[model samples]
Target: MASTMSRLMLGRTLERICKAVLLLCLVHFLIMMILYFDVYSQRFDIFSRFNNGRGANASRGPHHYYYNYSRPNTTFPSYLPGADQLLPTAKPEANRTRPTPKPIPPCPEVPPGLVGRLLIEFSSQMTMERVQRENPNVTEGGKYTPTDCRPKQKVAIIIPFRHRDHHLKYWLHYLHPILRRQKIDYGIYIINQLGEDTFNRAKLLNVGYTEALKDAEYDCFIFSDVDLIPMDDRNLYHCYDQPRHFAIAMDKFGFRLPYAGYFGGVSGLSKKQFLKINGFPNEYWGWGGEDDDIYNRITLNGMKVSRPDVRIGRYRMIKHERDKHNEPNPQRFNKIQNTKNTMRKDGISSLTYRLASVKKYPLYTNISVEIGKPPPRPIKG
Candidate 1:
């Protein structure tokens, strides 16, 4: 009986050991399968999106373990850990490549006849935007463009220019935009005196009128001082039936013209009216009498001076010392009263100036004229 019982116990122990070995083998197989799937399945999933034909169960006879994890119809894996050994899934298609992009067109060169139009178009959009933002009541798209711009029948812009570079810069910056917005196809002539000979403001203006007409016909002439910048764009540069004193409300006189006949900062004249009074006197070299002389000429010709609403004609005078050449003459007033009487003898037609040279620049042409010395004495005869 004892022997039989011991044999039975040994048999049971052997059966238990066999069962444990079978369980260990099963766990090992599962672990290997897990490792293989973790390593290869991720890459297969990525590449499967790009290619639709490569089957998920594609046969890999020797590496059949990886075949089960292979996923097709997916984007190719760019940086698979062991992918350096594998071939790249996608290749370049010679016909599928794209062409290079083209360049944009540049702005056209500005022409004299079209300069005003170009300016109008350039500022039109910006002006409209600004106007709408500031005043909601104003109409949109009303800003004038080259296509819609109309040349004023009789308008002129005379700019008195000198060595003040700062003044010129500000003048161009502010006034150009203003003039374009106003849509006045006005000729802008800067009467720049070339030399240091007692800056003859009035004579330079006469030169501008002559020079401007040579380029294109302008029926009206505006004598404008460069330093004065207008506060209002509404103050039209065009002449009314009467002479227009556009710069009546300048800061120099508390934004108001000091007297009734003030036409100092800027004044416009029609061709018939200007020629009727024989234009501005070429004799007054210094500042004071020239404007007064012009005023006298207008009054003498039976035309009255018209003014803007004093509220709107305000202008800012750039601060600067009086030009060295334009030393204030003590006798300027004496000559001012005589301009009307002497108009026929000392005007544009009677004036004489030597043409030094003309340099045609890339932009516009410049003709340098040597306006002869101011008469030794005022023409009081």
Candidate 2:
């Protein structure tokens, strides 16, 4: 009976020890589960804030987290090790838009309307009114500028006139188109000599140069005869560094230069070149000696004449008889011999004339002036 009682007590003690060990294992498992959930929650919260709470699974894996960190304006946590090396650096965004660029202006070296060779035709039916109607772009004072582009130079055409209405009409008909094609900003001035007292061609040119300056600051001055017209449009009326003689080959001389020293018909002079020569001689009353005297002045000033190629510098002369009172001066040869001595005193500085009137026609500016007669010749003993 005593042995049975001891065995029952031993079994009870073993059961108590086994229950204690099971309770300790349950507590350890619960603590481990709590710690693992706390770490996962903290990581999820960090990713949500980085993605602006767009979605819970926005950054699920390491690849997704790296892409979100590389986005512009994203803030990376400093506690994370080697975080900057996991993604590429982002560029800053621009605050404002870029501005547009302005367009460049056109160059005026080569004109678009230039037709190299022209067919020059004259008709009795062609009138000044018709010529004015065709050239509607010409302003009140015969001023014109190309519509397509700015001109390369400002030119003033000075035509010494007495009478020749028909020739003037033909000149207007042909030249206006040619000048426009050459792309020159130009004005036409018809310097009309009043009265019939020995037509002084050179003095009228001086007056034109003086009066044209009052109108505008013209850089170039082209002294042209009312009757001459260029056959080729390429014979530009613009000035050069030296004096330019445009009428190198005229139909009157069978398309050949009459002499080596001929500087007549149409000539271009820059402001500096004209001033250096003191302008044309005022004592030349008739047509013959004035051109030669001007040539001598050009040579004296150390500026050579610049001419275009012979084929391009061709001109046509209108057929007309000499004027009534414009007889050849008897003392032309003697006066020409004294050019070097008399040029300084007998040019633009000594020029004097009475301005009759200044009328602006549709085609040209007519400047009529009264120039006095030549001094009486002394009788030979």
Best by TM-score: 2
Listed per candidate, the RMSD to the true structure in angstroms reads 14.8, 11.5
lDDT of 1 at 331: 66
lDDT of 1: 0.64
Residue 284 alpha-carbon offset, candidate 2, angstroms? 0.6
- Count backbone clashes in candidate 2: 0
Instruction: Write down the TM-score for model 2.
Output: 0.73
**Which ranges of candidate 2 are over 4 A from the true structure?**
1-107
Find the candidate with the highest lDDT and give its number: 2
Candidate 1 lDDT over residue span 108-172, tens digit each: 22223322211111222233234334433222211122334335453445565667655655555
List lDDT for all candidates, in order.
0.64, 0.85
